[model samples]
Target: MPETILQIPVAKIIPHTLEKHGHVRTDNYYWLNQRENPEVIDYLNRENDYYQQSTAHTKEFQKDLFEEMKARIKEDDESVPYFYNGYYYITRFEKGKDYPIHSRKKGSLEAKEEILFDCNEMAKGHTYFNLSGLSISEDNTMAAFGIDTVSRRQYTIQVKNLVSGEILAVKLENTTGGSTWASDNKTLFYSRKDEVTLRADKIYKHKIGTAADKDTLVYFEKDETFDVSVYKSKSKRYLIINSSSTLTTEYQTVLSATPDAKFKVFQKRTRGLEYSMSHFGDHFYIVTNKDKATNFKLMKTPEEATSKENWVDVIAHRDDVLLEDIDIFKDYLVVTERFNGLNHIRIMPWSGKGEYYLPFDSETYMAYTTTNLDFDTEILRYGYQSLATPASVIDFNMKTKEKNVLKEQEVLGGKFDKNNYKEERIWATAKDGTKVPISMVYRKENTKNGNNPLLLYAYGSYGVTMDCHFSSVRLSLLDRGFIYAIAHIRGGEDLGREWYENGKLLKKKNTFTDFIDCSQFVIDEKYTSTEHLYAEGGSAGGLLMGAIINMAPNLYKGVVAQVPFVDVVTTMLDETIPLTTGEYDEWGNPNVKKYYNYMLSYSPYDNVVAQAYPNLYISTGLHDSQVQYWEPAKWVAKLRILKTNNNQLYLDTNMDAGHGGASGRFEAIKEIAKEYSFLLDLEGIKK
Candidate 1:
């Protein structure tokens, strides 16, 4: 495949006038750069004159621009096909379909037709389930799958009898997601959730074949905000029950499950470890800060805390960050930390004390926050990353203590010049003197200066890290003479807990400031100028992109917002929505004055006032169960009606799609086409 390289022109890239508008910190003003460029002043003066003369004509320009890009991509056959009918999927595309499971035609479900995994036949090829994830049993007699194409957000747990290839039991709709198969195939221990608050989940137990058909409510709480996470530890017999809930604004309740335990009264007023004799086990591991909620530590249970105590520091917490994940293997616990803007997976001693951080090859790692891991393989094989390096499958082995690459996605037939692309890791100081890291990837061959089209991306939310990996879609941009960069600022798990703490809650403005720092770096380093700059993000990232554009709309030529949560304050306060309760740990609960005011500070949707917006492309899916499509849809609609200046707000939505645009290869190809068409046209790439 031929890689796209940028052609830069150093001399005139950063017009002197551009450097004058430095970053100004204040919540009251967004898009602080409204000054006109002198060198591009003629271009700007004419653009402004046109905006004043015909306020409504530019909408037609949007159509013309998109068509132009579609034509250019047609000229260059290397671009991946982005379909519309269905978004892309994590497919079972291997070997010939003559085999049972593989035989199910690809895209069969696009028509809402039945797509089955020939359990009986496919299981024989060592391709059990012709799928992934946990199975019903080691014998492969029965199969359990997390079905998503059928539903959005909610996953239907289906158990099939491999011998008959029949679905024996199906839990049609469930908020209780992430189903795990218990040792006893007939008995499945799944976590059930009660959507009382958007902040947390309550769990239940389900029996597979019994008349007690309904999932039995087990460990539940009256608090509107509490999180319940369960694990079928390596012991294979004990189920580790972990629950965390914010008490007031800062305090919390952390509880663990014990086997066959009964609750007893305690004499000590507080700080005594609570336990039940027959329900929760004697051993318990929890994510707690007991000392500080912001920074967390993994703790073990005290055998007798009330008895003048045997309370010991099972895992003394780190002051730098919180424990993002906890995975257990043969008494060895794996704790993933968000530190130094990097996701480091650390192995722990049984006592949960000493930590040996595993060295990872990828610049960014999955916090292991979410994703199903293969317990038997001891291999960390699932997660997404796109940074200085190309996107790849990072498979780490626990047994051999080795790491290997599983796959690298690339354009099937295109020729790529990777050496022409160079990735630089640099830091830009925010107004608060907070140094933020930015990752840039561009074709080194195009040192012709600022002529290169640049794409700046970021998603600063929930303390999540923007990892380094590859993206075939990048080839669509890179192969077309464009450069790309990612902003690792505050509010993301990039540098760990301290990074997040600096940008979240009351300090949320740090996110916007850090993003601005990234854009400034691009100009200062002479990588690309305001003329060729474009910015993008989605969902939370959408909010980020939106904020950046508003903060400095004149600096960017085009903006992309995919299902952005710009309406943060409104959505967070609306209890009617989903996972709003489970989200408090990430975004502070806005109902209370402290967090309410915090959310209102930088909410892009609510803060939309009279301003010069950018040439914007807004995308959303009708079925996006996570961030409601209407949020972005309404934001675009209002921006169209509200912005006094003549700017493009191209609204796009897939009526049949969910958060994921479309499904399957064909549909995804169309989507890729649509996105690239719009982007290329905006950048003036010739067809």
Candidate 2:
């Protein structure tokens, strides 16, 4: 390791006092929240300079790691073509390009290719670019797409005349980067975000050739806690506007053929009722938690009478099974469920035939229905993958019980082999006697020794399950004697909805303790010891990284937190921040005394103490809309002043990206290389 002495960047502190629930606290690094302040930019730049200087010796090694990982990825990769509308759409990448080219073939794959958008050409001259919500018109002559150049997720919607290959003149600003076209191709509906909070609170209708300012406001979600979006139902009959919060949802619908018709509420919002609608033959299939169905259930209501009272159970709630989602087709209704912490795809014939689950051989794997757009077809498209196996896109015949693998992710390196790797699922007992699951993978040659370095990762919030899936980049760690594990902690719906319920709001500490328990279990089982264990997570999972280190800093040797939401109380209290208001149900509204007290107790920034801590690598994006850059910036600034140990602490801020980091495919690989290099360097692995 290089012993070059470097000056650490110390942010200027101007103490700011905040009082909430009659409690006062002083924050010295609060000024870092000033996104537009010159001093804030100076501090971030200095921090970046320090990072560059501190890791200067690893530059060549980082490059090697980047190339090694890049080699594993097939440069000219393409996604499985799914038949939708009148065309078969495909997204493919050229051999050396950083972006994808969207193209389509009419009627069949053998037809002449019609280039929709070559993103490589579109992304030119921009540091960051994202093309989202590509909605094709009913007539198949036009396409509406959203473009975000600044990376804050505020997209600009524009239309393209596919027939003439020319971008239309009108542009819609401040949208959520998606639009839904009415049956009349000339009319489109989209969701717009609030300029300050970045909340999708308004739905608007626009005519193709008109100015964006003249677009009519179809609906405005007055409740600050709710966000709205517009989309066309799969049946292509209705245009639906969905308004949702963390715990509640309401939808409005109108016939797509009548573009100017007013939308009628399908169901009124209730505080604890969460539901989603899918249009079918004569009714709308709903996946909901109404009537206290904690794990959710499948229900349906006639299209003419759309309300809670008219809803009838299609599939009753089961205590042990979580109804995650459903896909409707002309002859079969496919349901995606989670049972015993594994994905199960259930197929039921609409003609009253018996239903059965698709067989899966892996003990821990991710399987879900992919794109099944053609309703008349008997074949159902789905995806399957595990820690050791590459992802395979499969087409299953719902009637014949036959399946065909269309494409499998190719690991380009010659050294790769699925047979050489091992995957396992283990259980850990939490502090509350609750059992948590951990999915792990490593090279078969690796032994369960305390000396082996293990990287434990998780994201335990938003009822989002972190499934065990394949990753070519992960082979680098496994081959280097690293055991990669994901802790299915309480905040996720890994086990069921109850798992998520127990880890959120006032019970949020369960998430932190669940992770700590998993860490201890791995060590106790000789998978890895404290000195050889490390942690990693991003976004809400980044919050997990922050909390775990604060709660059990001595359990691991180091931690990597990407775009961490460390300043919990401060962020939750400020409604102007993106995602704050909508997440009140997840993290209790801190305005109340009880919630404020509980949040302050475990808030990472508030709980930073004068004690020894683990070596840390933190990352953030300057334009991150989900978790503002200031949260991590303020955290690092505070940690520097109060931490009692001289451990390695580094912060890398992506100057030209947002929460997901670099927009280019290869550029994203470079970020991963940097992270892996940090881990390998700590273990004294040079190559």
Candidate 3:
């Protein structure tokens, strides 16, 4: 078959000059920003068509890849049931179903089952549906959950009478898709976002059998920088309203038993201070960065006195370790900590005796606490996984120190063997003599020092650490002699808080450089070269992908960016866009001249110049609330005009989804298949 050449999309140029900080930028593709304009819709559809036509040769291959990946998954599967509040909740999927069925059994796992909500049924007749925040009333006779028919993430709150199996007449719209139930069982507190900015600003209290208009506005956050949310304390003693900005946090509390009581602030917000609280028997445990504890520490305050002055150190600050989270029990305090690069769960008795760490064999692995709902029990349930190991749920007896494997994810088809793969943690040297960590995995037979096709990935923003976790989809690459690696660069909390602090704001360039440095380090060490290397990330990580490709165009043969945030300066300056205002702390406010110039230096859309570029595959969702779809559309339009190379550049815009491409479990697999095939086709790999 003769190859069919694709006609590149030429977006109509409408000059829009954005003047800020005594500077002016004339955007040629700015007309694409008119989302409601039919021209904009037509242009996006045309681009999608071009992408499909360009990759038409791989249509059959993509289907095969999707099927191969889907086969590894257990078709009829049920998660490990966790007991919570007099019920054992379990989520299961039937063989051909696209969504999970949420159900519960009373008292014991063998007891009669009661279905909460079958998502497969609820998701029917809708292109996108998401159900979240399923909060059961304290009496266990009612349930309140949030649902979204559109992909914009704005959900409507729905109530159901569990005993009667009837949905109530009450409905609340524009919610954040979460609700906290009070001890009264009939009262619920939910958070709603600003209609325009989508900033979660208002928390409301709703009583059963009342219209949403009558719901009381319990609290309203005046600060645009801070977002608010509500949740019940683990002890169920308090309903906590947490308001947090990028750098600071403030928490208000109301007795869960007294739903109508006024909430009181535990501690006033202080700039640069961040803290989160959990309640135990007589005190509140605070994980905070108070007193310049860069890596954070645990402190305790009497239940009666929660002011900052009353807080005393329970766990002292450590310079080398980052305290991630803590789980309190009747006799044990299990702290999830990060030292070096791997996660560690350290178990300590309340009596301060017999302190130990749960041992993990993998050099690079993740282990964290799961739903340990009952504080009176000695058993701790946690999830554990690594690059080579499948996810496993374990129940550990704190007293006897016996660990029982409750469930290890079954990679169906009987073809997977743990012994055939090898995983390792390696360090890549950065420019300033700092050692960045990288977690790598490959089939044991392909581990020899050779220039193999390697996919290096990282998300270096928002203090979000990318851990070494197993993925059944990744096995497809591994089996094809491709090494998968995760770069634990700065901006991520993988190493410690200091690691994140150094890669953000004025020092944000470290993130881009760290990734480039890792790329060069891996290639120098003979893992892969520029000819065989590939890179991938999504959302904020997509921002990482955009920046790195501009900084080092020759670093990889191809790059995959999903729902990328490419137009930084323009997006940040416009506060009307969703998620733009709250992220000023992550990517500095471009309104200020200094930050404007800094962001402009690396803004991918602005940095596209007349130069040779690598093969590129970019994707976005038309309804993405996080990064507006037009950002990627405008970027591709500009790249088509300036890029000097003819290397393949394909853009896929999923019209049926939002920030997340697809809602169905199997449907999402097909998106991954498209991405994997793009990489494999470039490398000339075939089954």
Using Cα atoms with residue i matched to residue i, what is each candidate's TM-score against the true structure? 0.70, 0.99, 0.99
Off by over 4 Å in 2: 1-4
lDDT against the true structure, each candidate: 0.56, 0.93, 0.92
The sequence of per-residue lDDT tens digits that candidate 3 reaches over residues 357-400 is 99877887889899898888999999999998999999999999
Better-scoring candidate (TM-score), 1 or 2: 2
Tens digit of lDDT per residue, candidate 1, span 144-258? 6654542254545567775577776556345444554445555554454443333335455555665435766655555455555555544344444545443222111222233
lDDT of 2 by residue, 280-315 (tens): 989999999988999999999998998999999999
**Distance (Å) between predicted and true CA of 488, model 3?**
0.6
How many times do residue backbones clash in model 2?
Answer: 0
TM-score of candidate 3 to 2 decimals: 0.99
Order of models, best lDDT first: 2, 3, 1
When summed lDDT is taken over every stretch of 10 residues in candidate 1, the lowest stretch is: 11-20
Error of 1 at 405 (Å): 4.9
Against the true structure, candidate 1 has what lDDT?
Answer: 0.56
In lDDT terms, which candidate is top?
A: 2
